[model samples]
Target: MVGHVVRKRLYILVFAALIGLTALTTGVAFIDLGKWNTLAALAIAVSKASLVVLFFMHLRWSSGLMRMVLLAAFVWFAILVALTLSDEFTRQWTPVPSSWQAQVQQQAR
Candidate 1:
């Protein structure tokens, strides 16, 4: 009974922290961060998600196996994002074939 109350209090604290983080994120969005915008947004999002998982989901008190599962999920998501970004950023530097450009020019003529 008392444990449940403590858990609820902890959840309230986590919610407050999440709200603070959200405000910070919104504040940062108004500033000219240049290339840091994406990084800052991702950092705040991860922090908020961590708090939710730790308190709301009760992962903090869970067993090792559960923790590992959570870690694996994060790892997989990171890998997928990294691979996708790598493809996108790398393609920006590649040049289109002159043959294709010529075909488009001919079609427009």
Candidate 2:
């Protein structure tokens, strides 16, 4: 008998979990948790991504090599994000052009 018996049930459960998490994310958006709102949204997003990767991508059934590759990819992604944020955080703000500032002031009124 084949070992990897594909289960429709598992997919259904994962789908349901993703939907629930999405609803939770939507609900969280309206509440003013201030700093925690971003953290909560990020946590839920990570959970959803993990579910999609493990279940939908069948990474759970993947070989060790595949997992190592995934880990390496994550590391690379982390490096890229860190570098990007570093550049962003160190940037200098320039004064807006007079014309644009005038437009912005007009819009505010």
Candidate 3:
């Protein structure tokens, strides 16, 4: 049986890239970009994950059926995350009335 062979040099390069991306993620964590920080961190994380999956996981040399399955999995994950985030972001949290607060305090005691 024939098998696919990955070169050592390519593996080393991918390893270096993953390490560099990790450093970038850590560096970005120290800076306060407010809302943009999450987006930046997620982008870097996705990049790193992609590199690992493509090289180390051998997805790059995989068959079309395997790629299709992986794509479906990613789509499902995105859908779930989107639904959860939408529900969380759309909720309205209203403050409780003073009477209710008093009742809560009395109940606690």
Backbone clashes in each candidate structure, one number apiece?
Answer: 0, 0, 0
lDDT of 1 by residue, 1-109 (tens): 2332245677678889999999999999999899999999999998998888887877877789999998999899999999999999888576766778789899999
Question: Which parts of model 1 have CA positions greater than 4 angstroms off?
Answer: 1-5, 93-109
Q: How do the residues 1-109 of candidate 3 rate in per-residue lDDT, one tens digit apiece?
A: 6557999999999999999999999999999999999999999999999999999999999899999999999999999999999999999988766687789899999
Model 1, residue 59: distance off in Å is 0.3
- Kindly list the per-residue Cα lDDT of model 2 for residues 16-46, writing each as its tens digit: 9999999999999999998999899999999
TM-score for each prediction? Answer: 0.76, 0.80, 0.84
Worst 10 residues of 1 by lDDT: 1-10
Which predicted model would earn the best TM-score? Answer: 3
Alpha-carbon runs more than 4 Å astray in model 3: 95-109
| Best first by TM-score, ranked | 3, 2, 1
Taking all chains together, the TM-score of candidate 3 against the true structure is 0.84
Residue 12, candidate 1: Cα error in Å is 1.6
Local error of candidate 3 at 105, Å? 12
C-alpha lDDT score of every prediction, in listed order: 0.86, 0.93, 0.95
